[model samples]
Target: MVMTKRQIFVVFMVLVLLVALVCASHVTINEEEEADRILQLPGQPKVSFQQYSGYVTVNHVAGRALFYWLTEADHNPLSKPLVIWLNGGPGCSSVAYGASEEIGPFRINNTASGLYYNKFSWNTVANLLFLETPAGVGFSYSNQSSDLFNSGDRRTAKDSLEFLLRWLDRFPRYNQREVYITGESYAGHYVPQLAKEIMMYNKHSKHPINLKGIMVGNAVTDNYYDNLGTVTYWWSHAMISDKTYRQLINTCDFTHQKESNECDSVYSYAMDQEFGNIDQYNIYAPPCNKSDGSKATRQTMRLPHRPHQTFRQMSGYDPCTEKYAEIYYNRPDVQKALHANITKIPYKWTACSEVLNRNWKDTDVSILPIYREMIAGGLRIWVFSGDVDSVVPVTATRYSLAQLKLETKIPWYPWYVKKQVGGWTEVYEGLTFATVRGAGHEVPLFKPRAALLLFKSFIRGEPLPKS
Candidate 1:
């Protein structure tokens, strides 16, 4: 039907108003992002890339907020994918380990006096987003005191999803960007759970997250297999005697909700008497010398009745590196620059929260079920283990993956980087398994170049270099 001149003018006016509204919305989101941008971090060297950090309130009623640092890709950031990284402790800060020491661009110096550029930072290939998740870890916090003690896997995943949805709203430019979730240790639980939440949300939401895949290193998968694998790794690597191994196997019932006294005795004896002073996270690396005199005591000690508690605390490369993060992040200037701790949190910033770790209310005994679900859902899944990690050792990952009973797609073979063998990889029907040679629990810290190569391959959906 033909419109009258007046009707046409009204339609034109509505179109003009819609365009104006879109422009205004875009400008507001950009302004919010700019407000959160990092002008300059106190000891950092000038660089070409942009960075932004701030908090996204996940639970307004609970006054819970999570902190995040986004290091944009070094070049052509708009063309790159966004990768979110988390570190597992049930309570570790991604800023402390993943950002400062592993895949992020800056490395904190020994004295915490300065920062240096890492040539192998993962930001080269994607925009790296590091999140200090769940309230009470790192700069993340809650006004409600009980939130700290009540956190667990389910709550953590829910809060992370809320954070991402809110964060995407604040940075609308990245609303449709392809996203990948990566982490280690307990993040094995975090990454998949968050992805599942996103997948489920996408089915009903107006704007769905473009989640591509996930990769986890030295992950905590199954309690029974991980515990069995840890004991076997220690024995095979000669960290403990054959007799001690047999004793642990006989007494430890990983399936039991509680640790038997006999199991505790054997485990403690194995660590204190049998295992030497070497770092369990990286058996070949020397223990942290700069650690407070308590390192030895803490290393040998195991928390009672908590599955994976001992290993969770021990997951790091330079044991004292966390000390540096503590020093750097706790600086008042650093807090001001990152726009963190605006609430004047009462406690000092720590790498991991003991309260959360100790009181975490629920943990899935096995993540394999989620793995099968994700794999069947057509998500790209890659699991890598650092061979030298005695805590959640390669053996543990192998045992856990074996339970999936997947058909092999590619025979096991060495994958190379820079003319040297970086790792061994074997592809299954839907999952990929790889081992980083001579690497520890924190693989990137131990083998940055290889880690970057692996990340590139994962993002490109290419196999690791066979040459």
Candidate 2:
């Protein structure tokens, strides 16, 4: 039967509805991703928090924001270090970790095990501000769905700078503080670019932000080095076989010069040699292994057993911890705080390993130039990595850093605390790189003591304690 255009339109609409139902059921965590909206801070400390509300219109999209916990040091009225914290997931909430977990005013009590003071908290030493950035990560929101969709390193940094302008106006007191931007994970890219933007704005504006220094942990500053470093980290931890290591190197191009497909093939082949499941450290999807008795069964059956330890600990590795962070993230309010939402959507508290696979965009921003500019402008920069992070392995960080051929005066040396050594530090062309012992991507979570000391030294503009 011949049909009119109107009849065809109705038929097409029906077909679209059917497909929508099927895809909606398959809507994964990434698609359902929404920011953890801030209601109120649960506890009280000797801190002041005025929710900084601001709007940044980017590409005609207006983003609403909330920043928490602002204070001025007692003696340093005119000047003090202003620190900004960012949590990386490309879609994760900074308020979740920066505020509640790592280094804000208070920590959420998870179990009956009594209240745990975030002893390694960064706020004790600096004026810390936790921002839920971009349009959709946390308490920050936008009516524009496009604002929620695409993101990359560049856009995130730009949005953050804009957010700060509104934030500074909301709380104008701390504008003169020596600003230092710091964060972990994907923030490797976030911190440097924001620092650069602040400096760029300072050049033109009258009341410029007195920017000082920047810090990042287990940073994803460089993609190539971080990727190759993953294999080295896996091998050190004994997660992979020597045969697998050889296979990885042979298959993958560590240079990071080639397309991602070529690198994926190498990583994919090495993963196939082991259990047929996704290797979270390396981004390659898992292959099926029949003899391994299915991943779920092996995982369930291995419950009461201890997995074989692979990597030999370096000189100062603490056996007791290294596993404490995994234990900490599993608690309930920690879950609630991380997943707090204004809109009704299911939110999981744990960090998403395959974050980019979600609706989040690969930020097209290049932060290397930012880092270079910061160095040129005499702003001190520190990039630290926790040795045990699988997500953004320290080894991969080393690879990423190799791209910056800053003239090296000294080889890597150990940074110390009291009489005990904390981690290694490398100095090249006015930039500092340090490693925190027994920590992961989130430096404060696993090794708060070291993390605190690191910031204390940073705020003082002192060389990190020498070993």
Candidate 3:
């Protein structure tokens, strides 16, 4: 049937847009850009920027490799710096938690059947690289089988450096680019150690990483302070009874390398009082169960491997994100599109790896010295906290920073985002600190706009917006 002039014009415009979209989405990874290119994600929306997902082999002997997802900047491809993100469980997938849940370009739609654009994606300003590190975490794995048992802070740093060097070899254009290490939770350990390794790498090379800065959100800087702050936060927030609180302080040793039986008992009592029904990660968040007794259950990937830790707590406001991501990633089409699980690893993909967490070799190392060293080297360091987090609360971070005893360059003050107070901030001689007022452990997931403002400020080396 022949169409009218108006119909023809509309159809022509539609075809033009489709053509433009194909052109925009068809980002050619130059011949030098190695690894698998993402044709498209299963439920992705039409986007202008390109995304690549695949693995980088860090160890040839152990057949060890790490998975990464790279999302290029929205506008400038060549001019933007690369920011690498890691999420810490000592065993978490940066792609699942950081990329999909927090700051990536697309967030899983509520139905888990499609995608939606994140208004506050970190990719607005720079290229974002999310890595699932230490082999055996997320889609990253090792063929040699013995790798997981040896997982430790030092080993993770070494492998991460190796992965970076090899990955940079593939994307050679980023050689002259300034790279920043950014992560949260245990990445408090990962970021500083990796940066230290990069610093060492720079000493031996002419064309180095051009390492610029680091931004950590609610990071675990010191064990003693972190532990002390947790119990203190619980008591102050009225989550625990005064009796249990007093007993915890009197009987428990927060700084103990390994908690004694007595200490564990006291802590267990405290936890029983407050954490049974509430989400420990975010104290105020609702549990899987309710007073009405309706259950909001999460599904698991439950790979054939020995059961370890539950891959929970990545979601911020959405209580069911763990279930959603598990379902989305497990789809066969999604895996093929992303070039994932080609090796047919024995287990289903999980957001957090229990095996890695159980095998984690170092938990007592205080990273305060790493901070001191970074500060002394004139690196741009910033630490922000999500005020409502119980896992690694803002109080813990403040106490950890206090251990630094750095000279104060600026006193504490409220910082704003879009005329609203985002949180408070304080700047030391070599570091800047800020907090997200009402956010939980996963700040960006809960407060995207404020988190983006915080990130933009961090990336620009400016203070958090103070209007």
> Model 1: which ten-residue window has the lowest total lDDT?
296-305
lDDT of 3 by residue, 14-112 (tens): 999999887754444354353467868877888988888888888888899898889999989789989999988777788778998899998887678
TM-score for candidate 2, please give it: 0.70
Please identify which of the two predictions, 1 or 2, would achieve the higher lDDT against the true structure.
1
Q: In order, how many clashes per candidate?
A: 0, 12, 1
Candidate no. 1 TM-score: 0.93
Winner by TM-score: 1
User: For every model shown, what is its TM-score relative to the native structure?
Assistant: 0.93, 0.70, 0.88
Q: Which residue runs of candidate 1 sit more than 4 Å off their true CA positions?
A: 1-16, 291-319
Any runs in candidate 3 off by more than 4 Å, and if so which? 1-29, 32-35, 288-316
Arrange candidates, best lDDT first: 1, 3, 2
How high a TM-score does candidate 3 get? 0.88
Q: Candidate 2 lDDT, tens digit per residue, 1-467?
A: 99999999999999999999877654632232222233333333343332322233343435344334343333443455678888765655565567655676555453322234455566567666777666566445555556555655667778788877766654555667678888887677678878878888989999888888888887766544565677777777777788777766676654442335655665555455563344332222232233355432111000000111111122232221212222343445433444433343243323222233155455422356667788889998888888766667777767667667798855688887767778888877868788886665566755677888888877776667776
Tell me how candidate 2 scores on lDDT: 0.59
What RMSD, rounded to one decimal, does every model reach? 2.9, 16.3, 11.2
